[model samples]
Target: MQGSFCDNIVRSSTKDAMPDSLGNYLIPTSYSRIVARELGLQERELPRLLEGTGLPPHVLLAGDESRISGQQQLQVMTNARRISNDPAFGLRLGSQLTPRSHGPIGYLALSSPDLLTALKSLRDFLPIRIPFAQVDLHEQGQSMACDLTILLPAPTTQLRMLVECFALVIQSLVESFLGRELREASIHFEYDRPAYGDRYEKYIHSELHFAQPASRVVLPAHLLTEANPEGDANSYAAARDMCAALLEQVPVTALSMTDRVKRFLLAQPAGSVNEENVARSLYISRRTLARRLQAEGSSYRRIREDMMAEMAAVQLRQGQLSVESIAVLLGYHDSANFRRAFRRWYGCSPQSFRDGVKPE
Candidate 1:
């Protein structure tokens, strides 16, 4: 990929700052199951692969309701690398991907009228499938490039695996759509060549370039207008609508601003719930964040207070921490301030609340 295109992808990817809170960006459990199946892993071996990932194999098998976060997914990738000992494991995984593996996004792309529309659908609906990454397409004179960027904090190995898997998956999808692979197509990796670098040739039949500035796949621009053999305009329209509806259900945009802010506070350490910090984490200016919260009939201070009160109630119910320690955990300067806040929140002192005495 061109250097300018790579730089644009990196810059745009960082513009939308995402919160690092656990479970902030979730991928459907079905995707995980697909990956495991592609790896030829047995059901019983999943736990060993996901040991330190804070993810349970049951969740991956839990149907469509369950989800895994970006961090946990990276951990799983790390574990997979360790167990498989195959540096090109990602390429192998990607080669196994079928349209059904992508859920609705895959189907929508499959039925689109042409390659370009299918790619556009993938770009628009990718967040619903994988929320922690963004894909952008750029068309130059004779070649078109699809750029992929991960938005979450991940280890280098996991990052490389993700990009490699995506590039291969896209290549497979396009070949399936067009009934053949483009001779001019190529895959580029931003990182240096690995010891098993030559193995990439086994999966990507086209030119493979390493140590490039970005992770991208370049294809002949004329391929964009080529009609998909299975294309049905009517089916594509329905699937596109369904994909749009699913995108709305993603957690980041599904919740109200107030609820989102409250969740952000719940995920942070005590005393780190100020407007500036929260706004920065959410990739919004202080004023815009305040306005949105206000539009939701709440404010940052109110949400923070609610979060603190909820946490205090849970802590008191657990009855493990003393009032003083609880106060400290809640960022109170002293027990007296905590007591005052408790009184304001629940009409009782901390001890009285902890003692099962109802405020009257």
Candidate 2:
């Protein structure tokens, strides 16, 4: 496996963070795709990524996305490192997890109005992507810091993989967002530098600082306000709405009467999924709908806003209409009113939301 790994590193060489187990958060198994592609693994060799994790190779290669438990993911990474015998293998993987690899989150980064907003979105929404990741943003006198607090119950090997991967992943993402290398930035790791990796200049753009209190990346404060050229009102709004809705929709299954109503509302057109229609769809009288929702500690109006926020996000992500057009479609007479309502729902201006949604 090590020989194949060395050869593959030379052949493929290119690829794709982590934290601890917080409340049984599962990781996407599609990471196997990154391993396979980056390691130049042949079709039959794809099983190498999941080898001893009790997860099958086909699941690793599954066209649809699948998730595995934290323990299972650690086992998989353990196998990856064992096979590679390269201390910096995780950094190699991080190089491939470019900003755009994150789907809606990628849209948020690319369409942000400025670098600071993009970084915040990355900070705010990353938990939705990687649940155990805790990124603390701080402003020092001359620079900004992104600190990752790891709470993983894993061996040093797995922890190394996690930290190294996160370091380079952030480096790649910020560079992509800023459209330049982060020469004035640096990454600090809590662990000592491995003998095999002294600089790791290829994957991480910033100067490397090891043996720190926490693993973090710091950049000059002046760079934070730089505007992104790709930003626009439409794309940013849509991307933001999509990300916010995705966050709201986590735990994916509807466990409450309120949740079930949200699911029902989301399945139908936005404007038509009103109180009466919702009651009808649930096969209940309006009064019963009211009573059950009240018992569930929710109400029709609150649930409707959730539905509308999600609908607006979906439309914004699709990039087929202007924010004003979407507002009207959702029955808002004034676009400014829609903007205010959207902010209340998602915590950003309607145009600001589009800054997170990249225009298609």
In terms of TM-score, the best-performing candidate is: 2
Runs in model 1 with CA error above 4 Å?
A: 1-24, 62-64, 235-360
- Scored by lDDT, model 2 comes in at 0.67
**TM-scores, all models, native as reference:** 0.59, 0.61
Candidate 1 per-residue C-alpha lDDT over 1-360 given as tens digits, one digit per residue, 9 for 90 to 100 = 122222333443332223336545776665565566555565567787677877765554312245667777777777777778877778777777755466556766777788898888789767766778788999878988999898877778878888888887788778877787645788889999888888887888789899998899888988888898863454344323323332333364345666556544543345645888666544457898899888888998887787678767866875766787778767787889898999999998888898999896
Candidates' RMSD to native:
20.0, 16.1
Q: Find the 10 residues in a row with the least total lDDT in model 1.
A: 1-10
Candidate 2, after superposition: displacement of residue 342 in Å? 32
lDDT of 2 by residue, 283-309 (tens): 356888799889988999987887678
